[model samples]
Target: MIDLSSCLSESAIQISDRTSCSKNSNVSCMISPNSTPSTQNTVTCLYRTILSTRKKILITVTWSKNSLSQGLSITIGEDPSISFKVNTNPRLFRKLKGSKSLEFQGCKVEVFWDFSSARYRSVHEPEPDDGYYIFITFDSELGMFLGDKARETLQKQEKSGPRMAKFSLITRHEHFSGNSHYQTRAKFCETGAAHDILIRRSGELEGRKNSELSVSIDKKTVIRVRSLQWNFRGNQTIFLDGLLVDLMWNVHDWFCNPDSGHGVFMFRTRSGRDSRLWMEEKILHKDEKEEFSLMIFAACKNM
Candidate 1:
């Protein structure tokens, strides 16, 4: 029974003009209003901690999928700048499963995966639900691991037991069609329950100045904005799982330029610092560590 009354205030919200785009790409993909609905590419990254050379190391596993093929990439480093990278080539058949070894800061790390029989909810999903495994071994001890068949896979590969995963899933990025309602499952916090997030825009009147935007979680309406024309960009705070969550949206393009418009929404926890700073950035800032930021893109089809 959490209430979102504080988010309706006119003076508290801040609006900005930032948009979400590929982190590793220079070309911005724009959607046209007259374009048809097509598959969208997405990337999900998991960050974890492992022991290397008796010291802690951060490892990132990124699963990416697109229309052509799907594959995974692994990066090991003490920080973002000093990292070693390896990935599976989607265009080749050998990507189903393989192993790679590399040295980072003088520490030897070996990565392995077996996705030949991985089960996925759909072809578009990059991560599988079961029937597969991914392992990262530092020196000779299993440090980071994934998949439901971890133990079995380890036994087959003759690897030792793995230390508990210190790596946490901090962020996720996705691209989806904006023409229809967009939905996804997310856990607001590390110990929070997974909720179904639904976002959609109501049709606009021919001469009306604005449209309606609705956001719901677990099938229950949480926030509704009327006269979206004036309030298309704003931020609000709500209570979820006894925690304060800061919600922000920028749908100006969605309604203002339908032919090639897209919108960005961010859900973050209020850290007693300044919510306005996060509201202005609107997207995930690499330096923010305590907050979990989930970034999603809803773009209209382009002609």
Candidate 2:
């Protein structure tokens, strides 16, 4: 079932998964509040007639500022490919850092966010449903919103830390598809002089594509990872809120595989961010296709 009024309305609807069905999406519409739905009505009438005849209406959304421009064309299928761009509102960033704040350096860090990707078993015709895949790239080069306390911790370690092998403590959050969407967008916070964190990814790109999707919904994700690395004897002040605070930690890497049973890393994070922090690597070699799997795991610690 589809209701054009919900998403098209002035505010958000109670719907959980807006674009859940592909065929059920019948009305290809572009309802801009600033613009009129004049010519669109004719197209809608014919679409309804087609739906009545064919019993399926695969709708697409396209619009433009000029003559019903189709600059933004998004198809809706079982796994639709959507692409669009807009001038995003900067209120949130301004809210967190104050109106005049611009840079992210030396702020308080309370929590650590992460953006990581793990491949899942690909879907095959014989099996049809092996496992779906998803990729999360944190928007920030550093971690998410961590206030003053986080800034203080990382600076001390960046200056005079031991020269042992570099180990790391990584903080991972739950999959962003759930309620995590309501959390916070990704941003780099370097409140301390030197914290052992690296940016393998930074949130999503300009486009969003899924490998195997049962639904036609388009998803956007934001993530953060708190990682501690070792061996840095320099100016290590955490950077955030357009200021610099002191915080740094030495994170280590502990690996595991099917050959070896498993390894446990110290846990650090809140209940929401702590879930599924580690995904152990699994190796399977039987048929023409050799496969690998990763387990998600995370730990929380007080610095």
Error (Å) of candidate 2 at residue 154 is: 5.1
Q: Where does candidate 1 have its weakest 10-residue lDDT segment?
A: 16-25
Candidate number of the best TM-score: 1
- Clashes (candidate 1): 8
Clashes of each: 8, 69
TM-score between model 2 and native: 0.15
For candidate 2, write residues 181-281 as lDDT tens digits. 11112222213232122112112212222211111111221112222111111111222333222211111211112122211211111122222222211
The C-alpha stretches of model 2 lying farther than 4 A from their native spots are: 1-165, 169-171, 175-183, 186-303
lDDT of each: 0.60, 0.19
State which candidate has the highest lDDT: 1
lDDT per residue, candidate 1, 1-303, as tens digits? 011222345466533212211111232223345544333456555464635335556566667665456666677763555443333333465656778787777767787877777787556566676888878777676677888787676577564445444555555666675354666777777677887777766656334455777776665555677998777776656666545566677776766676766777777665555534343233333444456666667775532
Query: Per-residue lDDT for 94 in model 1?
Result: 68
